[model samples]
Target: MTIDALRHSPEQLRARIAAELERARNRSTGLTDAVDGDDLVRQHSPLMSPLVWDYAHIGSQEELWLVRDVGGREPVRPDIDNIYDAFQTKRADRPSLPMLNPDEARVYVSTVRDKALDVLEHTPLEGRRLVEAGFAFGMIVQHEQQHVETMLATHQLRQGPAVLDAPAPPPGAPAAETEVYVPGGMFLMGTDLDPWALDNERPAHAVGVEPYWIDTDPVTNAQYAQFIADGGYADRRWWTPEGWAHRSNAELTAPQFWHDDGTRTRFGHVEPIPPDEPVQHVCWYEADAYARWAGKRLPTEAEWEMAARYDPESGRSLRYPWGDEDPTDEHANLGGRYLQPAPVGAFPKGTSPLGVRGLVGDVWEWTSSDFTPYPGFAMFPYPEYSEVFFGPDYKILRGGSWAADPAAVRATFRNWDYPIRRQIFSGFRCARDV
Candidate 1:
């Protein structure tokens, strides 16, 4: 199904969101303790925000933008005016928001959730919808999925080993693999008409490029360490000017969580990478450096999507590579139930038709495309979203991390971040000309 079909009517969407919220409120452990406060906030990942604030942040936002404002109710709590806003903010530690004790934060979250639910119950589902609920629900789902990711990253960052889950396919179930070739050609690039994208995904214009080959698997920790041992981090020739400057400033010569023994990190109080696992926490700059050191380059967004959407009969214009179906574990490594990036070759059934595994999940893939707008693009009444990042800094990334909800992993989900930042969920794959 196309993204356009997922749009739900106002009443139906609200009912679904309310039901989903009930499930979440029932299922989640729900911050009963705060020992992991620092861990809960994804302070180290520029690609993520602190978990303590995510739901309330966006839930509160939907109220202001979608419900309250739409219904003509002035905000009841002006103190919250800027507290939950994300579009105007930068890093969480930059003091953009006041830190709330767990209690105040809980109260704030409850109020927002309840208010949205109340609106759903009271507002007539019928009249011309003020905003598209499906799109709004998509934003909520995306926002929550990002938090679960931040939480997983926080768990790994603070707790060391990831929480385990049902075993994925045996190693090499899909073979250790070889470079898969994508016969590229003219393709529609972005959802210029997709109303839900962030500012960086705007101006979804057509981009022409030649066909190329991309690795069937994402770059693993063992592979990245080889770059470091080869002085990939130390060499100026391997890095772009911005990347070099960033490395110089951060004094980062290895992955953020890399340790001397080189295998494990001390999350919360544990250890680091297993030789076979896919790497986590590397930034876009690091991915680029590794690609350069390996004598290759990161995939352009178009090439990445083209491979992921392989189907000679269906065409790459389809929303996701695995047909247009909303994702399930059968399709990707999403949802935190696994709680970690699986070993490469673990999901044979999940591979793109081109035989690329983990295209929809595992780690968010850094793309060579710049975050730009589609032709004749306009933000979906959420003014700050696509208009804010029209600047030159942000770069596009695709796929979702292991922490995201599988249902949220559409081929069209667009994410963007500055290249210099490093966090656990952002890593990349290599592409070269056939």
Candidate 2:
């Protein structure tokens, strides 16, 4: 529930990992039951793998890390390594590959988990490479949760009656003030103290940012509709050269899952757009164009962190907007308790010291900064996790989303994707110069 939980003893860490693994399996199982086995193998989108492949890969990855790497044990099934290797196999070719069917995947994951638990029970939790502070366990849990989010995205892209459901987020009042002015100052920008932080967020450093104004909450459907009505997408000046080219190539008129009938799609169901809810499924290009049309700009990653973490009064950055405590229902709409974004300004209780609302969850807010490493950044447990993707090509997204796990959401957490990616639960708010 807190950072303390992540840094706890071997027994506590084992229990937390077990619970999280179960949670991830429950989500995957629910999606699997919603359709037939054929649906599981059918590629919903070329960007993502088949549902069955994700199911088995989750097990394979667990075995690779917890069972084999940290536990110093032999591989459970070395032959399946190449099949589930994400870097080796392209997504479009996954269905043709020799992947385990749904039943076999389920059984394999169950067996792998059983063996991993036995290893956890006996392994020491201190003074080791991966086992120190239960790093491998936490990493494996987070990895599974990340895949759970990916599988949920596959559900959103698939077409049919709604296979998943959750209650709507709490209503929100119209955003007050419209923008919060963040003072220009040097602020600590990443996590050095949190043991569970990923490699990209390590080696916290001080960053100097100019004073800027940020939206009080995420941009809403009503606001984005104005951009669409104004022919924002038709105009090339508002988009970056690359963004424009991508948009033109894809013929993107609006967010990926939105329909032409004034309704938005979620988990294969269509419903009228909730004017108050934060606009989601928007890519960096659309978000950028919307900001330009509104006479604003996307906040730089440094500026975004300054607003979310700096406390003028306390003179120290807090772990979350509401301080060093785990998120509660009052704080944010998270853990997929709701299937959609909470309306802008919904979680006022979660506002930062400068009164920025909905800073932690509901949607992953796209910042203007490129994905890059901090000063003194070093590869922690592996190179493939974050080091492989650092560059100007990928944009950074701060904050967690509705589907994000509680333990994995932190102020220093970093998420990145290609700027054109819109299928993930992504949205943005506008920022402006002072």
Candidate 3:
């Protein structure tokens, strides 16, 4: 079916949903299958779960939402639901749980997927909010894809030979300017019409922003290296008191995985740091300190969104930086096509109307904004997805990374984490007052 047909026809929507479900499963299995049973069952790091847990948890979520809730079908594995409950179980403790083993997890997920597809066939696409426009299926697709990204991060942290491989990203183009000026004005900041946008990104509202200058592309490794060379990490003036305390306690002198000799680990291979690629694995504190050392600051969430989605002449926010259309390989480096971020300024086609580039793919850009609900926000489907995490304790990150799936990210999508986290694929650009 044509991509557009899925929006109007029930049969086409079901087909699209099935394709997405299968695609997510392929990525999940590919990551797990590359390693042995021990690797799958062992927790690579305390920050993430055992690969086997994620595998079975994905199946449990599908069964809970699609089979039991949406399809009114009997439970496939009611006995292990609590063991896989993310909110109830912590990552550090999941390895000790009596979760399914690698072999059993594979079978459990396969059975759940078959039942989910059956539900998709019988359930009407209209009526309730969850199933409307195939939102539930879309949510599940996004959920699985998110876990895939998390699994990729765990793989990065694994201590051993690299088992993953992918072609290098395309070379970058020369940027005409270092920074682009965004005029002060009002723009719609979130989504109201997007069927799959999570609760935090809903009820689009107008936000008034002031004129500012934002980097045309994300800050590059070479530029960040300058900050390190200038003793940015040791200089107390560059970091907030909280940031300085964490940096001192953790002894963080460079981005995670960097060696004092100027080489860094990528996947598992040691190589010279790519000067042109966007810096990855940086915490918000590090990004903020680097920005301060450069006499700039991280962009606020509103400013970042404005630069990414607003078109001054049209006075409308496009669904993505380039335009109101879904992402493709040419537009952004996404869907694990490349294991690492494309070089800054690589995807000219993905540039926003204001000439800001690389806003959608490469790394999750840290913003100064705290994670909070938008005006008129309401809980939907479940509150655990977003509501429970809303507050200043979490900082916001925008855009998608190379590991992120296209279905899981958009201009309006929101990701949040503690400010001290550096394991995720993250980076940032700078902005300044005009």
- What TM-score does each of the candidates earn? 0.84, 0.97, 0.98
lDDT (Cα, tens digit) per residue for candidate 1, span 141-183: 4565555555555555544433333444335343555588777
Q: Model 3 misses residue 349 by how many Å?
A: 0.4
- Clashes, model 2: 0
Best by TM-score: 3
Per-residue lDDT tens digits for candidate 2, residues 1-434, read 46686557667877776686777678767767777898898998999899999989989999999889877788888999999999899999999999998888889988898888888888887888577667787788788888878888998888777768888788888766889988788888897777677889888888898889999989998889889998999999899998899999999998877788999777777789988888889999899989998999999988888888899898888889988887889998888888888887778889999889888898899999999999998998878889999999999998989988776788888999999999999998889999
Candidate order (lDDT): 3, 2, 1
Query: What is candidate 3's lDDT per residue for 1-434, written digit by digit as tens?
Result: 12243367898788888999999999999999999999999998999999899989999999999999999999999999999999999999999999999999999999999999999999998999899889899999999999999999999999888899998889998689999999879999998888788899989999999999999999998999999999898899999999999999999999998999999998898989999999999999999999898899999999999999999889999899998778988899899998999998889899999999999989999999999999999999899999999999999999989999999989998999999999999999999999
Off by over 4 Å in 1: 1-14, 22-55, 71-74, 87-99, 122-130, 154-176, 192-207, 266-269
lDDT of 2: 0.86
Of the two candidates 1 and 2, the one with more favorable TM-score, higher being better, is 2
Superposition error at 223 for model 2 (Å) = 0.2
Query: What lDDT score is found at residue 45 in candidate 2?
Result: 92
